[model samples]
Target: MQKFILTAMLLTALMLAGCNDNGTGPKKENQPGEILWVEVPDSIQIPPPGKFHKALVKASVQDPDGLSDVDSVYFYSRKPDGSLANKGLPL
Candidate 1:
């Protein structure tokens, strides 16, 4: 049950963490970086109840300007209730 909840939260967070838009609509020259792919485990195992489980998540991004133009990539998780996690951990 815990694993399922965690998985759902992770998926939701990723969906919310989509690329940023300038708000003026799509411009070819002002296009933001594209997320090539993301990786996450199908299932995660937690040992003792209080013990924390470390899940690996990775994302590959590309920018029209260049890799240097990319500022940063962050990972944040959502709560089971579909809310942002404790102010969101920018990891």
Candidate 2:
């Protein structure tokens, strides 16, 4: 019907109006610096289950600015409730 067509057109217009680029969305520009870590083991086997385990992670970092921009690298682990645990470990 004409009413349904008018409603659809109004909705389409409203959607288009709401979709204006405000530049507040996710950054579209390439970052000046980036860090990429090497592929790690899928899972490490802990022998005694409750034993303390340690791992050495390696990464390759690139920066168009300079390495001085990077202060420190931190690592994090997820807890049982789905939140990050232990703040972060500085590398």
Leading candidate by TM-score = 1
lDDT of 2 by residue, 6-59 (tens): 999999889877885655677655446677656555455656867867776677
Cα distance off (Å), candidate 1, residue 28: 10
Error of 2 at 54 (Å): 2.0
lDDT of 2: 0.68
Cα deviation of 18, candidate 2, in Å: 51
lDDT tens readout by residue for model 1, 31-68? 68898899977556656977878888888888888898
Worst 10 residues of 2 by lDDT: 82-91
Give the TM-scores of the predictions, in the order they appear: 0.50, 0.43
How many backbone overlaps does candidate 1 show? Answer: 0
Instruction: State candidate 1's TM-score.
Output: 0.50
Candidate lDDT scores, in order, read: 0.76, 0.68
**lDDT at residue 74 of model 2 (Cα atoms):** 62
> How many pairs of residues collide in each model?
0, 0
Residue 53 in model 2: lDDT: 71
